[model samples]
Target: MPHGFPIYPWLCLLFTYIRGLNSTVGESRMKSLLLKPRSCSRVLQGHPWVFAGEVQDLLPGSENGKTVVLRDSRKRILGSGVYNQNSKIIWRRYAWNKVPFSMQFIRKSIEKAIQRRPVETCRRLVWSESDLLPGLVVDQYGDALVVQALTLAIDMRLPAIATILQELTNAKAVVFRNDASVRKLEGLETYVGTFNDQVLEPLNLDIDGLSYQLDLLKGQKTGFYLDQREQHALVSTFAKGGAVLDAFCNQGAFALQCAKAGAKSVIGIDSSDTAVQLARYNAKENRLEATFEVENVFDYFTNNRDERFDLIVLDPPPFARSHAQVEGALKGYKEINLRAIKALNPGGILATYTCSQAFSMEVFEDLVSGAASDARRTIQILHHCYQAKDHPILLTMPESAYLHGLILEAD
Candidate 1:
């Protein structure tokens, strides 16, 4: 050989090359995907959420609420998500892109949602994953902002989100109503606190030229039902000069609107003594003469057959919590609607709603039809209402569309 050790070295080099190639192939095949050792393929296949059981293996040292890269079992990148070590939903994917998950992203998402709406006065600025930001919901009531962080990922990102909200909207106050029961499912404790430098008090808002007070710290769902703003206005359009009955009226949202719309009289009923008192206060605040009674709506309607109304509203709370409870919930819905239809005078209007996602549109319609049959009355469906546009729904995820109401004419 011209060069000493050439043949031996060449053989060794070839052997090493073959060994390395084999090793690389094997490693590629065996590489574990996902932040943890679990089934992440489902999420990769199109599901937006990754449950704790689906994690294949946690990256050597991923902390709770850490932003992490998601991958499939083949080590192929899936997307990016925020990891919650203690939660059953281990990851809430924010984007499919590899872009940095920063405060700017949050700000942009909020801004996009707000910009989509024609009216900026009062609206839902962020709707969790519907806005591509999972577990984060932000509602705007005039200058006030109400936020609910439902996941550990969102909980950890709360400060960033708050800063973005303050900067983007110039919100006077940002109230954190993190008291939803869903937090417990995430293994996080419930908390209600305020973020940013803003006052915590009942703030007055102008909705369709009517003044309404919202108690950010003490009210329901950020002190008012902002999602019902459009529906309230719609109800007011047809309420003039009628005797209205608003069952399960919370803070007089519908009842007060009916009164302001020139309803001759309005009677609001709720089981909670506190809600009844608040409804009365709201009526007085609006300078509207309305009656509020603290009584179980079911009991009140079951016993009082002599009373009738030109219009009746049955916007009750959700009765079903899961799919298994849908049947019973339908019964409750039918019962209430039957009573409402029976109480409606000739040519009266019946506005009914079911906030339960478990109650499908078909089932709710069937319930209304059955109730009309039981009441021995003919009803014409005048309008069907859904959750406001600010609460956007993903076409792929039907569960996001929950609130449903119907306006029926009983004759």
Candidate 2:
């Protein structure tokens, strides 16, 4: 080959190297974030999360929990947040206006969250994203508080969080149930322990005259289904002088309430032996005669062809945790609901619920509608119920409205 031809090949290689170098230098100069137009608009509209994919580019040298400036494609500073590259939710936004990521900020946010909630003994103290303390949740069961830190930034600040929580609520004990599966996604290790480094199991919680024993360290979802508090009270309205069935009865919350509401008989069924035992204990502790048995709800419904109830509650755990599980979750929901509809006599009340955010309200309505069709029954929608007041859903964040319920009657 000619010497000039070799020079031409060298020229192409030099050109490509210069372009890559320029691109790297440009990204390195960027301050943590440069969101696409769509992402910037979402932040502008008060949505807190900044997904990892939403970011057009991110600069290095930004540590987790440090204030990172977010900018639009046009390079205008939109807002700032605690950024962590490891999380799918890269930014947990603190404010639209700039704010310091400091102890003072944490204290102010905690104080604001507490003021809105009931200053009573038992309630949700911090509701994660809804209360604007994203990745952090705190619930008060009497004097003890359960804290769950779901993300790396929050998990790293456990000591500070524990100190502030105790100070604000005057909590005698603080238990951390950071053992959720979601923690793995955020690159955090699952942990469970108390601030005082000792868990007081069989913690007594008295709610609306019902005394319940719970193992706070080992119990599900911060030791109880505190979100269902309002539903338990409301379900009792139709339970008076009727036979009631509480399917998927975790700890007998609804079943006990129905018995206390003057139901002739209340039969609660759960597949979990532990839940059944705890529920039976709770029923006895209240001196309420309710039958709780360890039986598969689906099997019981399918086998017991002649049994019918005046009222039935189908409060299942989250049927769909992720988007991919929606199809299977809908099928699961329809199966139980169909069984419930078939077991209900004419004028029977069906208090059905879903805690899956993936299953939208419209979809839940359709699921119930489809169940009614399969059962060949006429149903009337009586009431629309949501999570208790303590777990407030933010307007911008629709996923916070995870719990949806409907009280219906067969005709």
Report lDDT (Cα) of residue 265, candidate 1.
90
lDDT of 1 by residue, 1-411 (tens): 111223453354345334432121121232222645455345645666777667666543235554566776666677766666666677667777554445556667778877887766877888988887888998888887888988765665666677678888888778888788888887666666676334476777776666777777777777778778788888877789999999999888898888888999999999988788888877777788899999999999977888999989888988887788988888999999998999999999998988898876777899999999998999999998899888887765566788889999988
Q: In terms of TM-score, how similar is model 2 to the real structure?
A: 0.90
Question: What would the TM-scores of all predictions be?
Answer: 0.83, 0.90
Which candidate number has the best lDDT? 2
- In order, the Cα lDDT scores of the candidates are 0.76, 0.81
Give residue 314's lDDT in candidate 1 (0 to 100): 89
Q: Tally clashes: model 2.
A: 0
Candidate 2 lDDT over 1-411, as tens digits, reads 111223453354345334332121222332457887655446767777788888886545346545666777787766657677877788877666555455667777899999998776678888887876778899898889889988665665656777888898888888888789998878666667777455476677788779999887888788889899999999999999999999999899999999999999999999999999999999999999899988899999978968999999999888799999999999999999999999997899999999999977888999999999999999999988899898998888878899999999999
Report how far off residue 52 is in candidate 1 (Å): 4.5
Model 1: ten consecutive residues of lowest lDDT: 22-31
